[model samples]
Target: MTATTTGGLPVALLLPGQGSQHPRMATGLYSGEAAEPEFAAAMDEVFTAMGAAGKPLRADWFAERPTVPVDHVTRSQPLIFAVDYALARLVMSRGVRPAALLGHSVGEMAAAVLAGVFTLPDATALVLDRVRRLADAPPGGMLAVAAAPGELEPYLGDDVVVGAVNAPRQTVLAGPEAPLEKTGQALRDALFTCRRVPSLTGFHSPMLEPACRGAEELFASVPVRAPRITIHSAYTAGPLTHGDVANPAYWARHPVAPVLFWPALDALLSTGDHILIETGPGDGLSRLARRHPRVRAGTSKVLPLRATEHGP
Candidate 1:
């Protein structure tokens, strides 16, 4: 059913990216064979789209001791995507049609898929290819700096560069191992409170240029369409345009682009009162959304959904 009124406060979905995953998350979503039919059916559809890897993927998700840690891109990226995609379905199943969706990094893929920019089979292929390329990328990681993006610019070298601008005072820097470590030390020496982001390779830095370039053909191979849902893009810090999604270069460039999440979030929440519902694995985005003025003023709220025995 359509919403009762657009005049009312709207809810926008927020999907998180890397650094928000943990093993055996949302176990309650699988309460039983008949529990949360939408979540289970949606999960089954996604995993089946994964082809031969589906079995192990599901196993690792529920495994007490996963063979591979959730830190690696091989595991974390795809798993995070699956969980986020499934969670979105769960939320939509509850008869709540969100006004818009916003995603951070890999989480954007889920948003796009839900928006019909890509089909399930196509997205599965794309995610798998993304995982393969990033896993082969040069050893690198991201650093969370509790300072403005400009403050961290001086510390960025040829290798190290700003990865994401998450908030006015929160930035993430990414690069290869040596320069990232060197830069981290330099930031620490300068008394900036910064820490490493876990199990991440520098997908957002210049180091991934070759990988990004290689993805062009693959990205173009898929059928692209306009989103049925409004997707606030962190890459562009705005709602995605048809011209943008239809272009292979746009999708190809995502791997190395600096994510402007704060700007996008600003755009999303600026229009009116919106309760930002985090539909990903953890409350990372919710924590960031809480820093917004609207949330503080009680005009908006941030809800992080977890797998309940019933639903999201």
Candidate 2:
């Protein structure tokens, strides 16, 4: 791993989760200097297979429109991955290398690719399969609860589970839509804020146990390798290694595990103060990073890679 500066600050690559994807997210890169025909072609094929024709619009539109659905798990997963891959390619083309990489949920696949754990083709394939399995799961979904992670425990039940601990006060809960709705209502009654996620399929909860098993089997069929750079594990809340890559079960069970982002960020910050770039279509991760005290202390800089005057 790259050591931090004298101020002990290390740079990190932050990849966003599903909610950050937009239609036309990759359109800006269609003709850029960093544009990769092979990558674009592969994405096109994937979208075709998924029955989607093109990229979603950028999340910026959500600010102006209230009804645009950018949260469909299938669409959100691939688009965010594609857009983040494009941005990473653009950054690499510009000669910027991060000390480490961390991604939330499906975004981890892109980070894995960047870290050299898998080729783009293999990663994309795995992601598509993962999305398909997730979509086919039972009728459930996720909800975002705006409260301290521990505070939300009271709302969890046999059916509902904490999907992700995004920040100090932001936690995502996953389960059946009905149970999630009930949990959301409970949070509201407790004077807490809550919102439903895009797709109505549960992820990162016990509901995905079966999917995890399938993932494990598929991972065993594929090859796993060591990343060239440091890659933090959202599943483990620490760095991942080549050995860990051997377990397809980890990837399979990952969706059902709570995202320990706070600890991941804590570990990243311990390395040093450095620039933090959000390799996706929106500024959600960047915003989250800024909410950290160390980040607010100017120990790190958060940048979002969008289109440039010359294009993406």
Misplaced by over 4 Å in model 1 are 1-7, 31-35, 307-310
Q: Which portions of model 2 show Cα errors greater than 4 Å?
A: 1-10, 31-70, 306-312
- Residue-level lDDT tens digits of model 1 in 1-312: 232234467878899888888887665575565367677778888899999988888888888899878888888888888888888888888777888999998899999999999998899889888888888788999999999987877898877898999988999999898889999898999999998887568868999887666788998889999999999999999999998898888777777899999999999988887878888888889898899998889888777885342454
Clashing pairs in 1: none
Model 2 has an lDDT value of: 0.72
lDDT of 2 by residue, 1-312 (tens): 223334555567888776666555655455467565644554454444444333332333223442444565566677778767666666665556678998888778889888888777677778877877877778888888888778887889967988888888888889887888888888898889888766656877888777656677777787778888798877788899878877776777767887887778777887766778777777778877888877798767766665341332
For model 1, state the Cα shift of residue 136 in Å: 0.9
Question: What TM-score goes with each of the models?
Answer: 0.94, 0.84
RMSD to the hidden true structure, all candidates: 2.2, 4.8
Question: Least lDDT summed over 10 consecutive residues: which range in candidate 2?
Answer: 53-62
Candidate 2's displacement at residue 231, Å, is 0.4
Error of 1 at 59 (Å): 1.7
